[model samples]
Target: MKIPAANRSFFLFLFPLFFVFHGFVRNARFIRVTDCLVLTGAYFLAALILYLLFYALLRNSINAALVASFVMAFYLFFGFIHDPLRKHSIFLHRYSILLPVFLGLTVLLTLYLRKKAPFTRLSLYLNLLFLLSILYDGATLTWQSLQSRSPRFSTVAVFSEGQPACDTCAKPDIYLLVFDEYTGSRTLRDVYHYDNHGLDSFLEAQGFHIQGKSRSNYWFTSFSMASMLNMSYLNGISHPQALTSDDYTNVWEPLRKSEVVNSLIAKGYDIVNLSPFDLPGHPSTVSQPFIATNTKLITYHTLADYLERDFGYVLQRFIPRASKLGNVYKTNETVISRTIQASSLHPARPRFIYMHVALPHSPFLFDSSLHRRSPEATNVDFRLKDYLDYLPYTNLQAKQLITAIKGNSGGKAVILFMSDHGVRAWHDVSDFSYFFNNQNAVYFPDRGYSCLYDSISNVNQFRVVFNKLFRSNLPLLRDSTIFLQDSE
Candidate 1:
């Protein structure tokens, strides 16, 4: 009885465990063990199949198992580490457990089914699968992009009908400013109508005509920005998954060459980007370069990137917000400060400055000093109440940025202000039901007067801006598939 070679992929058994455990222990959530078992069995079986796949490729049974295990781990980590099931909106107890488990099982079955596994044959098969998956992903993404609907808004008002003469003749240097989670005016008016007046008035004073019904298409920044920047209407997107062979991959379509940035550049405007989420290697960093007309974009990468490049993440698990607290800063306020710098550069061309700010996005820490709590488990005194309570300073910082931008633009700039998405299912929209529901943007903190999601979503945000900026009589995208105003 000879002992078998060490199958390196044996660790693939842990792939299912990692995903199952990920949901079980994220940010503190509760799940049943039945769900756990289902996941475990599903993933284990999947690993078995992938192991055989290795058997065919590598004459060494051990090496074959290792190859399969590597693939299993890659998917498990991609799904678990990045998209913590508990934190995701789609995380259903039974499905979250069963689904990932099923994926693991599928891969295992694939590995097991390969005939009389020889290293050469098995490697060829694995290589083919990898190449096909990549090509399919690319082609499908391209088609979806081309098929996506173009955005235009529905409105009674004709903004393009009138334009007061300003020999400043600087092609309406568009400054599409999106303040992450900066809920829109229409949202406040409909939901928290009473409290919304202040915001409404401010926009009016700034010459911004808030579309009382302006809605967004998608909830997340990635989808929403794609639609807004391209000036197209996107209803929603289906993310790709590959648990079963039929379960194909889906992705966001890339913007066409005719979109805003290119159109602007073609019409002679320079583009500069500023995304607060810019932490080294952020998709935006790689992506913005493609869509951007100029490379002057200022981005912070990610909080971790900021922490590593600047200070140490002493508060890695439990951390502090980088808000100002009268000097002696731990992590300097990099996000806001960078935006101000970007704004100054805008005046140089018929410039298009897109600032994706994320201070208000999350880790919900708005403090001048260190975060309210630490990992010590002691009463860190940092109450969770309004962790983003530093909105005033946030607002002030915004004000300073705007002031600086205005000065540089010579006081003439069309600033399209909006939020990428909503507060993370907590804080202001802290109601468990409201936060967790499909609703992303809500009228909370008392709806501030009017709520947006119940009335309209991000589906139609860019239409109003394009109409306002380009001055189209048919300003609002009237053809939106969503029958606005009577979806009731």
Candidate 2:
């Protein structure tokens, strides 16, 4: 097509600019300046290919080229329409009809617009609209970037006692295994009506002292973990209302850069972090082969959850293969696999393994027998049955981890098994009780120091451990629990 050089340049830049804008918005958390440059370059290449094809198709008709570019720009910028198409499953089952109708409408609109306007007039209007949209998107991105750099609300600092000493001849390897949203046997039996005796018996027989009436210090993962790891209640140092806010910077800071981890490292222990969470100080033992081992992907798993809620069903109809990626039921089998590796016998430094297993938590992937549940069986609002259904899989994996670590450690390791919180189904008032009822168990080496009580809260866990093992005088903080509703 014999398009003006100005018009051709405008069309070429617009689509790639739109791509760059949207890509940056979607990936702002992980995107670096370098990444932005690469994304712009990639989209430019794509835009060039499309421009060549459209030029060839127009066959020297300047009007056709102008209209085609406008139509293409419309479709590219309005791709959010694809989201609505995916969100509704009923339309997708009959996508045979719906898809064709949509395509026909688009084609008809393009044809009408082409014949209605001269090339120069249409190009001028499109260029103006494109410039406005690009400016708006670019401005918004810049504002957000600046806002994210603003100083976050600071909270209390994490306090620690003197350096923990290894009183024993050899410092035992430490394992802190956390299963997300897992409740104790009491809650399992009383509320869920599921007897978790088998796993309890297995641990008991293996010499673990189970804290039967154990509770968590805080109501949620971030708060509970921060308290437990730092060995004190968050309210002690941080503002009393800090937990009421979702700003977990105080919690995350101590977790990623924890004195507990540092103390162990100073004492010749290698920190092995196997959680999917991006705790940058410690290297991950698991291989994240799916997502490139980058800072953005791991830290932003919540985005996947957001997509599934908004577009999962619709996506399933079009790209059935991509359903797994959208499936909230999917487990991090790689975590289990790598944990097994971490627990294996190797001639290395004494290790402290921190593993966060996010299963038996949501989408209720597995049944009582560790088999993946059918999609039909899965529910958005998982019930007690759904929670019970996942027990077998997690139980099996938990047993395997315990056995592997014990076998590898040669009777010289301390294993602490706990949950960040209990069953979080907020439907029933009584469900709140289980929220505080956490699963807690510890296996100290050679039937070592036993100050374990039946009613210990997570905050006092490491305090007791350091007191007994390291001969430190860390006092037990009084146990407490708070029922969290929201960030309000």
Candidate 3:
């Protein structure tokens, strides 16, 4: 069927709108729907401006719409085209070679459209195609949202109301400080050849028990943390195969509504989320570092993102704020300050503060002197030496943070300091077992450290805590590590 000329120009706007919606739908699990609002409005405005400019030049609405569609497609899909070509051929990756090719194609398309009659049939096909694509994504997003609202698992079911609790037990302020990518002391000594005994001794002197052979139950943060907080292995809550799936809603749902957190809340404990990501009811105190909350698929894969990944050190010299490395520095600084403030709060109810500090992870931003390293010095190579130098800075910060917490809480707080996983960036290493070796330490005011063992994985950390502190007889799962295919 042939469409009327009056509606042919509408496809130009529909294509751009579809582009934005498609990207949002792909990343909806990580980001919120409202996060894409500004970007959608911007794409529509750009499409309108391009259509008006092309119509003024071509003197035909259908011809102008076709040209605008071609431009929008090229602009939005540049990164997708560049990434694969760059991996295979150097010449094909260069903007000097690719940009001119796109320009020439656009020019030839314009000349062809000028000679031919207005293609109303092509416009109708595109309009139907884009409309169908948009509806599909919208439906998928709505179904996922409804599923999330009614999750398969509930907090009430996880922590039964009949579970035992100690009414007379002293509920000291509990703190779980998770340091991302801090390898175990053994890994530091054998792999990196750096002795982390100083930090261990400091923790021991301050009434902390350091687990020498600690390992994470899972390699990825979401899986490890979800298992840790829920006090169950991945197979218990959801399918073990879901660990490899791209969609993390199953893992993240259990994490957000953790049984440990819910049980604490039920016992009159305040929850403080000072982490990089949100928890059940509380949002993150600081903004997430590299990826902003409003990030979408197209925004993350733009030409600028490729440049930042490849040539960020050089660009940082010119525009320091533009670098994501700089953002990591700012985020770590804010997390430290805010954590200290949260510790000092003397609330009547005992508090459970979850402070996840992303340090010694990536974007090695600090030196041994506690000064921000120069942009040129920021190592993307993930070298062992770079990691060793950065570890001392983290150690210093950890010491200061622990001391402040002890002082503010009057030596009456239970602190659990551990890492999500070990150093995962060492690509050349052969033996991958060290990837699970993470740092684990705990400080209990009552000096009850007998229940803790040497090789306790993250999945059993909270179980021991609950049994010791609240008399909650949660059975300790076997300490074992399930290595996933991908670390991230």
Identify the candidate with maximal lDDT: 3
Q: For residues 29-113, what per-residue lDDT tens digits would candidate 1 score against the true structure?
A: 1133565577568777777777655655555664556566566655554434433544565444244564576578656755564
Sort every candidate by TM-score, greatest first.
3, 2, 1
Which should have the higher lDDT, number 1 or number 3? 3
Candidate 2 per-residue C-alpha lDDT over 390-455 given as tens digits, one digit per residue, 9 for 90 to 100 = 888888879988898888777578999899888876774354667788889899887754688998
TM-score of 3: 0.87
| Model 1 spans > 4 angstroms off | 1-169, 185-214, 235-251, 254-258, 276-283, 286-335, 346-348, 367-390, 424-475, 479-488
Between prediction 1 and prediction 2, the one with superior TM-score is 2
Against the true structure, what is every candidate's RMSD?
Answer: 13.4, 6.4, 4.2
Of the candidates shown, which would achieve the greatest TM-score relative to the real structure? 3
Report the number of clashing residue pairs per model. 59, 1, 0
Pairs that collide, model 3: none
Per-prediction TM-score:
0.48, 0.70, 0.87
Instruction: List the lowest-lDDT window of 10 residues for candidate 1.
Output: 242-251
